[model samples]
Target: MNLVRSELLKIRTTSTWWWLAIAAFLSIALAFAFNAWVANETLNGNAEELGVTGDQASAAAQAANLYTSGQYLGLMFVMLIGILMVTNEFFHQTATTTFLATPRRTSVILSKLVAASLLGIGFWLVTTLIDLAAGAVFLSANGHGTLLGEWAVQRALLLNLLAYAIWTVLGIGIGTLITNQLGAVITAAVLYLVGTQVVGLLFMLLSNLLNSEAVVKWQVIWPAIASTVMVSEGQTDFTPAWWVGALVLIGYAVVSGVAGVLITRRRDIS
Candidate 1:
């Protein structure tokens, strides 16, 4: 309990958290702007021309998209928050003092995990609220009306929160595994922002070349798509079951976290 409290206090005392808050707000604003543009295109009869017709331009669809936009775009920042939560300790050489206080490496790591998860939840909640408020104003302004009460929208929002929470834990694992702050942050950014998409695209091309449906279904990206699609209930042919996606994500967290814990236990602090 004390270790967790100390971890929380470290976050509270830092400027990094404040910077992340600002970044989140800015990210939400960008989401609102993007959604508003889409809404306006639909209102102006340009939706079909822009490939946003039928169910794609529906209130529920728009709302769901808007609600989850933060998760889609702002996820890197949230992940960075998680990564930095631990990496910063190492960067400043404060891990030695932290370990001295706690003595047990597992307890310290667990406390960091708890702290990162809490920060992830907090980040999601704040960004979601911003998304809702901004979406409502823009949606209603464009005559689409606020669709916050829609079941699809509600479900997407909830799942988005869950995804953000999971991503944070994943960030903590990455941070712990790679203690070099810059290297960890860069690796995370590349993996999420570029690597995942590139890998998915390559898999898709390979699937096309090989003519294999199974390959597409079982690829690394499918689980991620499945998780989002399951929540939004979006029409897609390739996504796996929601539970399967959840398990895949959990698998990532567990693997990274366990590896980090083992390394931390074995490595010298000096």
Candidate 2:
């Protein structure tokens, strides 16, 4: 009970959580706004130009696309929450006392992982809801699509939430492994924005040149690819299957978490 209370209190008293929430909100809102405008403009033009019918259904679909948008942007917040939650304990030298009191190191790390994941997912859900509401209103006002009676749109929104949760869990695992605030942040950023992307691009280029099928499979290297599952209906460019992407993501998280657990058990807090 005290542990839970302390965890909750730590989240509340810190600016890190607040900043992450704000960033999530901004990411979703900005993406929705920008996409809405683009959709509106596209709908106003001839269907042949944008390769879509300028109709109510089109508008609604576009709005939903806008709402499910911005996974790349929102991921930064996930990383922030995950890394900070784990790394802050080390920064404050609180891990020593925490481990001494808790004794069961696994439980301690699990608590922090759950707390960070929840914090990240909660913020993402809130932002997604906001985008949904705003997007519905915008589409209705523009006569692009009906706000209600659109089951597909709703499904897209739900998928967006699910993707965010997956990303958050991945971040939590990375946070656990790094444990140092700055180091974790850098690692997360590099893995997300730089490392996987650069590697994926290189593989794609090489695959094109060599006509080697294996090079195209680099999509499974990071869950970052699944970030697009929310939007891009029907199908998308070459990427790993959704389930494969999810597993790859989960694999990374599990590996990092297990490493953290082993490290925590072996390290002397004192």
Candidate 3:
């Protein structure tokens, strides 16, 4: 308990937490605006192209998307909270002291994992509230209503919360592996932003070259795409189901987290 408190205290006393929170907030707002625009465009276009039932499904999908808007950016910020949780110890040269106080290296990292997960949940709550408010307003104004009672919207919300917690835990794993604060942070952000797009395109190209859309299914191997797949409104043969995405992400989280803990046990803390 003390160890977790210490970790939490470390975060509480720092500017990084608030700075990241602010950035996440702004990112969420900006992302909401853009996603709203996209949702509107999608809804308008679908109404023109599809029949009644199809249009209704499209509207529901867009509503779910609106409620989960800013998800990618919000997740990116939560992940940073995790990466910094471990990297900061090295950055400040305190890993030795922490390990000495705890003696059980596993326990120390576990506390960090716990702390980061809690913080990630915090971020999820904040973002979810913001998304809900924006979604309700937009839906009501457009006469679609909030659709809050819809199973799809509810599922999206629940899955979104899970995504936040897991991503943050994964961040801790990343921090443990890299240890270099800047390297880990930059790698997390860039690889997520650029990596997802590159990987998607590469998979698409492979699928085309192979004349098999099945190749695109491999894209979920990347955590970012897997995250998207988790709350995805639609699925096709080219992509796996939502559960598959969740499983792929959880697989990465477990591998990276366990790898981090095992390495930390033997790591030189000088």
Candidate 4:
């Protein structure tokens, strides 16, 4: 209990978490606004192309405004937060003190994981509310105001939150195992940014060059591929089923976390 309290204290006192939260909130807000704007523009263009004017075009635009922009920005922020959650300990030399104080390395690591997960969940909840509210307002302004049921919205929001939180915890595990701030940070960044996209492209290219349909479709089994599949809206025709994606991601998180624990327990922290 004390160890948990200590971990929470460290998290609360740090400025990094606050900065990340602010950045996440702002980024989600901007993405939603941009998506809304683009939606309105496209709808208007379509309306003009079809020779439809006024309220009809506005209504069409509103309906088209339900995009996945909020998820994109929120995920980016999640990556940043995940990187810091692990790296910050090294940057501040907190790990040494934490281990020395706690002695039981597993306890310390578990405490940190719990703290990070809670923080990630809290941040996601707040940002989701803002994202949904802002999206609704923007859509309503354009004359397409179809309010989603509270329960459905809440469920979607929770799924999003879980997805991000799991990723962050997985990152924490990576950080613990590596113990080098730079390496862990880079890995987390790559996982979120470059890793998945690179795999997706390579798979597509290989499929084109080799004329192999199975290879192209099966490539989504990679960790990066699976992560993308999990986050995408409503499973595109090319993407894996949502349950497969979810299971793959969970597998990655579990394997990485266990590996981290084993490494941390055996390592000489000094």
Candidate 5:
């Protein structure tokens, strides 16, 4: 309990928490802009570009999609929060003092894992509230009406929170495994922002060359897309079952976390 409290205190005392507020602002602002644009399209009778067939139901669905899509942009910020939670400790050479106080390496790592996860959830909650508020106001102003009651929207929102929380833990694990702060941070960014897209493109090229539908299904196993599959709720046919996608995501967290714990336990802190 003390270790957890200490970890939380470390985060509280630092400037890192500011990123959460920034993420919330960006998320809400972008969501509002996107919703407003969709509303414009709906009014201009060009909603067909977004697959809205000039019907109330389809328009509501399209609006819901636009509203939720912007919230995912905040995930990158939360991912940075996770990476910095541990990487910062190493960057400042504070891990030696932290270990001296705690003595037990496992306890220290576990506390960080807990702290990062909680912080991640908190970040998501704030971002989600902002998204809802901004989405409702802008969407209603644009005459699109709020679709907060839609199950798909609700699922996407909740799953988005879960995904971000897991990402923080994954960040902790990666930070622990790779002690180099810059390397760990850059690796996380590349994996999430660029690596996944590259993998998808490569897979698509291969799928075309091989002419197999199965290749598309294999894409679901990638952590980034798996998280999307868990939240997208039947909107995309290429995704696997929700359970399968969730397992794939959990598998990533577990593998990275376990590897980190093992390395932390065995490595010498200089």
Candidate 6:
């Protein structure tokens, strides 16, 4: 409990958390505006031009998208926090003191994971409240029924929380591997922002080359796409089950967390 509290205190004392939170706040607001517009277009019979059928499935999918829309940037911010959670210790020269206090390195790592997960939940809750409010207002104005009553919509919201937590774990893993705070953050940011796009393009090219949609199933193999899959209602008829996405994402987080702990135990901090 003390270790966890210490980690939380580090986050609270830093200005980084609030800066990221502000960025996340603005990102969610923009996402809701855009998604709400899309939903309105779909509901108002602009389906054909938009490639939607304006059906229940489409509406539910859009609602799920809107309900958890903050995830795109939210996960990124969580991951950065996770990275800083560890890298900050090293950067500020507090890691030695932390390790000296808690000689059992494993315990420290575990506490960090717990704290990062809690931070993720906090981000998830804030975004969810904003999303729900925006979605409710948008739906009512459009004369569309609420998908809040639907299980799929609810499931997406729940899974979104899971995504946020896991991303932070991955971030901590990155920090553990690369203690240079600036390098770790830049590496993570580039991989997340640019890497996802490049990966998507690669998948598209592969699908085209194969002349088959079957290759699309493998998209979840990538951590970013796996997060998307974890929350999506459905994309195309071939979308893998949500649980498959969950498993793959969990696999990444577990591997990263485990590797972080193993390396930290052997690595020389000085």
Q: Among these predicted structures, which one has the highest lDDT?
A: 6
For 180-244, candidate 5 gives per-residue lDDT tens digits of 88898788788877977987888788788999756776787777877766665443334455567
Predicted structure with the largest TM-score when compared to the true one: 6
lDDT of 2 by residue, 23-98 (tens): 7677776777777766776777654565544232265566667677666678767766666766778899887888
Per-prediction count of colliding residue pairs? Answer: 0, 0, 0, 0, 0, 0
Estimate the TM-score for candidate 6.
0.95
Worst 10 residues of 2 by lDDT: 229-238
Candidate 4 residue-wise lDDT at 241: 57
**Residue 141 error, candidate 4, Å:** 3.6
Off by over 4 Å in 3: 45-57
lDDT of 6 at 245: 88
lDDT of 2 at 42: 70
Q: What is the TM-score of each candidate against the true structure?
A: 0.85, 0.81, 0.93, 0.78, 0.84, 0.95
Cα lDDT computed for each candidate against the true fold:
0.74, 0.67, 0.84, 0.64, 0.73, 0.87
Minimum summed lDDT over a 10-residue window in model 4 is located at 59-68
Order the candidates by lDDT, highest first.
6, 3, 1, 5, 2, 4
lDDT of 6 by residue, 165-235 (tens): 99999999999999999999999999998998888788788989989887877877888888888887765
In model 6, which runs have C-alpha deviations exceeding 4 angstroms?
53-57
Any residue pairs clashing in model 3, and if so which? Answer: none
Positional deviation of residue 224's Cα in model 2 after best superposition, in angstroms: 1.7
In model 5, which runs have C-alpha deviations exceeding 4 angstroms?
A: 35-48, 51-67, 139-145, 235-237, 241-243
Evaluate residue 45 in candidate 2 and report its C-alpha lDDT on the 0 to 100 scale.
69
Return the lDDT, model 1, position 84. 90
For residue 60, model 1's alpha carbon misses the true position, in angstroms, by 1.2
